[model samples]
Target: MRHRLVTRGAVALCILVAVALIGYGLAQAMTTSHQQTVQGTSENSPHSGDGTKANPRRTRLEVGLDGCTKGWDDPGAGAQVFDIKNTSDRPMDVVLLGTGDKAADPHHDPRKAQIYAELEALGPGVTRSMTTSIEAGHFHFSCMPEDGPVVDGTDTNVPQPSAELASSLPSPVQHAAPATEQELIPYTQQYEEWVKGQLPDIASQADQLKDVIQRRGPNWREEAQSIWLTAHHRYMTLGGAYGAFGDLGDSIDGTAAGLPQGPNDPDFTGFHRIERGLWANESPDDLLPLAQGLSNDLSSLQDQDLAVGALEIGLRTHEVSEDIATQTLSGVDDFGSHSGVDSARAQTEATQKLVEILRPLLADRMPADHLTAIDQRLDAAQKRLDDASAAHPQTAPADLPVPERNAVRSQIGQLSEQLAEVAAVTDIRRAT
Candidate 1:
């Protein structure tokens, strides 16, 4: 459902490239301690940046090969701002976690620790800030560099608030302990198998589209369009496995977003390309080749290893709906077919499947009511989509009534927010 094709391998390479760029840029900016204070703001000053009335307490922590959380002292409870500076030559990711009673030493087993906030890809000699409100608890900072093992800062104990202070302090931030790679592997593997199961239907629909194009009988164009929609919808249900498909996916469903020649690019071959040709009144003969190519790609996809990364599986839980709301509903991904809403419905189906697959893992980690709310939100969004499709079978999303479109968007936006927590909870954390 993404505008451009991006694989897990590609994403890793990009991060490595970005780290190299940051190292090169900040080659001369390295310094010792890296501790700098804000001149104007005191620890007790009320900060309105994040719309909270609590005073902002600032602390600096150093991250590098030598140590992580170098200068951190025991911080007090309440609103806090941490300036995490990367002192190493390589880029690093930093996570602020609340260690529950499960682990005596938080760093030794961080998977059980709940994440309050995190900053990713903090470059060398660069200072990145994270603002969060904390309740009295055991907390620590974990720093992971590009090419080294995870390093942890000293455990910080924020004393419990007194009765009077508790009444005045903000509520504790909501967080969940992250899952480990081993814990997530089973779920990812299950999801992978489910994706593999969908391939048969997708390939079959592609074949149907090609057959309709080849017939060219009376009303054949309309029939071809319908078959194309069916095939496209089936392909879209594979939303969570997008990155796993990699370039093959691009060849099957990729849009012409980043292509040099746009839609005219030679590489623009897939469902969208076929959609354009069919809806733009191109000859059936012209579309047959594209349809054949799509079928071939789908067949090829079945043969590949089709492994879904654990991290990517977690991320796709939120991203599938996000792409639907941002790209599919917005019509940015629509070629000439004007089937954005239809595509969104298919993607919603994908989201539902992803949530179902991860429900076992999420049950204990997430609040019961939170999981129920997600289901309710997803059902509400699906009902709206179903109603829209039944009311106007072939209309564009933008051409729909404003109230209908807004209702769908509102439901989807809320759903995306709820799924974001799922992403956070299922994120695989590094353990020492």
Candidate 2:
């Protein structure tokens, strides 16, 4: 009996040893696998930035009343984003600054250039984010070499850029130089003609936007939204390229698609701020940063303002119209930051604010007959939006290729001219 028991005990001990060895081997394999997986993670991980987490990109950077961004509203608002392909042979740190003819300073109060985000040294082929918070303002983008700040003790009293220390900085973009003014001039002229064409159509586009909004059902909103977004993007881009909206979308796009399509933005309170500044009153605050981001050599931006004045022509149509209380616009400001949806939202919001300023001003100043005529136009605009809302977005995709968008661009151009008559602000009473 003792011998049998001893044999059994010996068998159990061997089995236990085998199981323990197998478990240990599996654990070791898993640990090694996990470490390797981590090691292979992308080089741009925030951790790769000196082992720190990446800061969430901001959409709004506010300094008192001043704001600036590449996007329509701000950075991440609706600026065209493309990856920086830095194949430049030079080894340098790239500094991003908002610039005009005037230089930028941290202490320099706005009404001049403003400094936003700075991305430091990025060796060739490495990528980094070009990011800043979104605010409804103007922004100019340019890159300076890392030494541009410190090379001659020029800005020495100013602190060195924090971007320099960022390990995750993206390589700065530097476009190849144009060898000839002849090559550049046609491109400039083409852009000029394209913009000049838009000033005539601002009113019609606004009317089209209203139709897209009201006549269509909830689903059709996206299609209508895209129409105005393209219009808004054009206006903002024109503003950047030229400086203000040259009275283009003044009539139809403003009050109709502006916020007449509200209840969409969730935050309903901000609407009051827009209404008070623009429509209800004419304090210089109506335009805020829009009014401020100006430089002494301001012809380009001023032309844009003229375009914007053209964009405001809709205020004439909506002025005698107290119908907005009855109209419903979705997500009036609900478009969240950085989402593609936000661009549409910002454009719509900007239009509403513009009208808010123009309507009250137009009503107070324009003749009764003119006000009545504008009201009739508003009635037509209301019907158009009603029809558009009833149509399906899928019926006509808003993202029709660039050619279609450009083709449609003509109508918006005609609309701008319609608004220009209203722009004769001989009616604008001095702000008491």
The best candidate by lDDT is 1
Which residue runs of candidate 1 sit more than 4 Å off their true CA positions? 3-64, 70-91, 101-108, 121-130, 133-137, 156-169, 258-266
Give one digit per residue, the lDDT tens place, for model 2 in 111-225: 2333333333433344444433222233443332222222110121112224544344332221111112232234334444554565445434444544544454555445544
Overall lDDT per candidate, in order of appearance: 0.74, 0.30
Worst 10 residues of 2 by lDDT: 24-33
Give the per-residue lDDT of model 1 (tens digit) for 375-432.
9988988899999988977778888999988888888877776776676577676775
Measured against the true structure, the TM-scores of the candidates, in listed sequence, are 0.78, 0.20
The Cα error of candidate 2 at residue 263, in Å, is: 10
TM-score of 2: 0.20
